[model samples]
Target: MILNSSLLVSIEKHFCGNELLNGEMYMEGIKHYLIDMDGVILQGTKLIPGAAEFIQRLRTKGASFLILTNNSRYILRDLQVRLHDLGLEVPQEAIFTSALATAQFLHTQRPGGKAYVLGEAGLTTALHDIGYILTDQKPEYVVLGETTTYSFERITRAIRFVMAGARFITTNPDVTGPGEGGIVPATGAVAALISAATGAKPYFIGKPNPLMMRTALRTLDAHSEDSVIIGDRMDTDIVSGIESGLQTILVLTGVTTREQVERFPYRPTWIHKSVADIEVEG
Candidate 1:
């Protein structure tokens, strides 16, 4: 949604408890919110407490927000369907995935470039949407993204491709992720294997690399100073938000615990038990 001055003022009055009536004063109350999906909104297939209501509140208040995720297994439509099943009605346009970010990064770095992609529908679909040709025939890049099953042949091919002078790229640096059975190796783990074999480090295009955050902000037409990022992980979401110059809120309903937060060298702008405890109205 397009945020105008009047809308900003109204939101400020509702949340900030200030009726300064000036656009500048209202703008200080957060024009956009970048929210993480996995930990902060859902744990595995279940929705976190107050996640649906919090999203609804944002929609009802006409606040601009994006559900950002690093998992590149499912496309936007698939993710929307999953959220819908959990009773969370999020618009497809408001969802941003690391695969999409990687695709955007590639498009800017080398428009219409070809790559040997080792990923699922999310990554392949994003690359296809951006007109990136996926092939193993002397590709410019060997792009790696998350998948439930990492095939030995695919990893071998990716290693060979990288050794053949193809630059390596990955969606995110998450070494492990939650699975129905338990924790499973993710993109970062596979990337490490390829790196070990090929001695080529993959450029991570997802969280902790401010590029993804900046891209999401650009998509929402948001200013970093007037935006807030809500996430559960300090390593990925929080650090990315901070590096992107956005205010960060760390929620403890996911991988990060209250005790673990103290171990980080940097701190978020705000801390909460979960999305349930966050107050839009100050």
Candidate 2:
């Protein structure tokens, strides 16, 4: 059955009321939350103030949540360790990445196609885990994700392969990601650069793409009315949550600032400066 647009708008307006009233959310009850990593939970290497405690509170109240990220350079296990180190108790299955979504998409569609991957161990491992073979030896597809070892040679090779009729795929289109040394180039930048060179557009698998969100909902077995998606970016997080039929909360700790939000065409259901400012009462 098709969902109603007016219902979505009403849900959005209700959530936005929390932002208008400043930091407090007094809804009926929320059962699940999909949270972002870099900006909403932590800025760079440090945890966002009170995020760990907020998560602990959610857990104490028996709420279901997942950590969703557009970053594809790290796998679920990697993110689990990182969040644990930051004092947030997150399970491996509760972590979802664009890489995982891309891998899932590839598994259902291509099955066992040979792929030329221009990414780090994360993307390679994801492809391998999904039974896709990795090869630079005339592959059927060119996969782009974040790689610290990105070289001009690698980009040139990817472009050459795509130009030779290889299909292209990407994890997400985030131009940059927040890191310890300020912002660094993300997988999307590399994809754009290669797309420009090869004259072939790549299909994105993360944020704003419903695959990951659908997977998350299935994993959690939760409905849209009982859940909310929180993140720092608008194009990725806000758009994804809105499209996925969930309430949206934009935290201003990482990429998009308050002024930038005003300039954007879309708006989140709620906006907060940091997770520290969000207090959910039982």
- For each candidate, C-alpha RMSD in Å? 7.1, 3.1
- Candidate 2: tens digits of C-alpha lDDT, residues 9-121: 65556456656757555544678889888788977777889898888877887888888887788877788888889788778977877788888889888898899998877
- Pairs in clash, predicted candidate 1: none
Structural RMSD, model 1: 7.1
Which stretches of candidate 1 lie above 4 Å from their native place? 1-28
Off by over 4 Å in 2: 1-24, 179-182, 280-282
User: Best candidate per TM-score, number?
Assistant: 1
In model 2, pairs of residues that clash are none
**Model 1 residue 27 CA deviation in Å:** 10
**Candidate 2: what lDDT?**
0.81
Candidate 1 has an lDDT of 0.86
